[model samples]
Target: MPSLPLRAALVLMLVWPFLAQAQPALKVALFEVAPYAQKEGGALHGLYIDLVRGLGAGAGFKTEIALMPFARVPLALERSEADLTISFSTEALEGAAQALGPVALVDSVLITSLARSTRELPQLKGALVGRARGGCQDLAQRAELALRWTDISNFDSALRMLALGRLDGLCLTRDVLHHYSALASIERSRLGAEILVGQRPALLYVRRGLAPEVIAKLRVALARRSPVKAD
Candidate 1:
């Protein structure tokens, strides 16, 4: 039993939601990996993408994600070619890059096909290791492996090389083995990976020279949630 003015006010209140605008443009970069960054049917989808989308929505911004090979990700950041990059190990945050928040803590491990011979760290001498370019997981220990490094651009290729026994080991986050193998129809039971090193904290890195306010907003958005997905 509201009066005419009250009825009109209530109608306006309900309509205000429809009149609201969409989020503003916020450019984001994503590498080809899953449950983190994966592209299918001309659209980006994954856990990290979801987490960023949540942040963008919560912070009032629209996301413009660019999918690229993992190796090319840091190069894009080094050249200030991207506004933001999906999470990566802090060790790779070189050049003018600055980390925003810890997005995930994943077990970065070395994987090999079960058929291939497994070796301990000391036994890795003279062994061939495959890893993504621009990655710095165990670059410091490369000399210990006699430094036979083969930079790969795609996960399936690296796994394929391992299955073919062409590479002694391929190091990456363990989730890559679980998700990418399912996508590529490679059986996971046929492979094994060990934590060649300790867990790594993955964080989003923004190239220097970006607006401080934008970086601050992103940091606050992520810090509030911690976005800590243990993968």
Candidate 2:
């Protein structure tokens, strides 16, 4: 017969799978935005994707990433369906989730078709403007602009619409504009001057009332890393 210690070890080995299954990984929500987060060939890779992975390692927890629409991230966190996400620091967002820390200072811009001959916001009065669904609310609310804002399902389609004169303009981040424009082969000359909307802080957010220890570990890890910037 096997020794007592050997038999006990065999018993533990048989139950290790169940023990591992009982411990859930931290859930993260990410959206498709090139250079920040993207899904390619069934793999997630981007600046934020790498940053989150590093932070998870430093904080001593495994993570599971879910790709969803940007607008839905906050609700996921609010419902405890996800543990973390990256978003712009907005008054509305603050009311929804606890911000972990600033991840980057991103430039926002308003771009229109050069053919439209409109360089400034007020000039776009009564014109149709395209925006990512639930994005760029701050820019759209500028008192000087009196344009009709429309929700776009994707950047690719929006850029195509702008190139074809279907949209009068689009409000989005500078990096996002550059990325999708290139991917769609839209020339810079096709778009008018980018009106600067000022820099906004991109922040990491967690569900409200998350464990204090976890928040501390994540903040410490985040502080040790460099912030992402436009390429």
Candidate 3:
């Protein structure tokens, strides 16, 4: 018969694999970008929220989502305070985060103040334009505008600042503006004209140094949730 300690050691060796296979619970930081992510009736809902939950389920992971300010998401990822975040763009992607998969959820628009009395699209050169700190993607090449950019934490703040004449215009997704128009107390008619500035893909970002298997599972889950469209 095996000694008592030998038997105990064998039992632990068998049990440890099972424990390791158990799904890990992760904290996912979500931002209130509207239509993409937001809180409603004390629960989170939106395209990105649904996609994230579906991905987590497929990957055998349990997730708890907390709404966070947009600008703080990068810091959270860098600090390992949040395991996952969503809706990040190419321009915003940093070395501290690992991007999993892409989702086509945003098309940007540029909105200017009606109070400025400029009917035509104002030349952005030398203008004080407001943009959400981590929300804008693919806009860095517009260096010719010499834009006085103000980076706010969220869409609502940018809208409010523009309405109050603190900004000449705001650059963001039209869907986001429509989602928070009522909450921002800005009339839709007063938003003046909007310029379509092209669309870009958004992706889920996780803290760097995650296991490759975990990243693979996340990519498979996202692919199942939002299949890549043919060009």
Highest lDDT among the candidates is held by which one?
A: 2
Q: Sort by TM-score, best first: what order?
A: 2, 3, 1
190, model 2: CA deviation in Å?
2.4
Question: For each candidate, what is the lDDT?
Answer: 0.72, 0.81, 0.73
For 117-209, candidate 2 gives per-residue lDDT tens digits of 565667777778888666776776665667788988788789888878888888888888988998999888777767787887778898887
Predicted model with the maximum TM-score:
2
**Model 3 ranges with Cα > 4 A deviation:** 1-22, 90-92, 115-122, 227-231
Off by over 4 Å in 1: 1-24, 90-93, 113-116, 139-142, 188-193
Model 2, poorest ten-residue lDDT window? Answer: 87-96
TM-scores for the candidates = 0.79, 0.83, 0.80
RMSD over all Cα atoms, model 3: 4.4
Which is the better candidate, 1 or 3, if ranked by lDDT? Answer: 3
The positional error of residue 99 in candidate 2, measured at the CA in angstroms, is 1.1
Q: 1-231 in candidate 3: lDDT tens per residue?
A: 999999999999999988867757777887767777788788888777876787788988888887777777777777888888876564444766887767555667778876653534436667777787755555545776676778777677778777777788888876777877777888977665677777666678888867788888887777776643312
Q: In terms of lDDT, which candidate is stronger, 1 or 2? A: 2
The per-residue C-alpha lDDT of model 3 at residue 139 equals: 54
Task: Tell me the tens digit of each residue's lDDT in model 1 across 1-231.
Answer: 999999999999998876665434777777867778887888878878887788877666777788787766777777777777766663555564788777777777777556545646656666677877756455445565584678887887778778777788777777876776777787766565454555777777887787888888887788778646565
Worst 10 residues of 1 by lDDT: 136-145
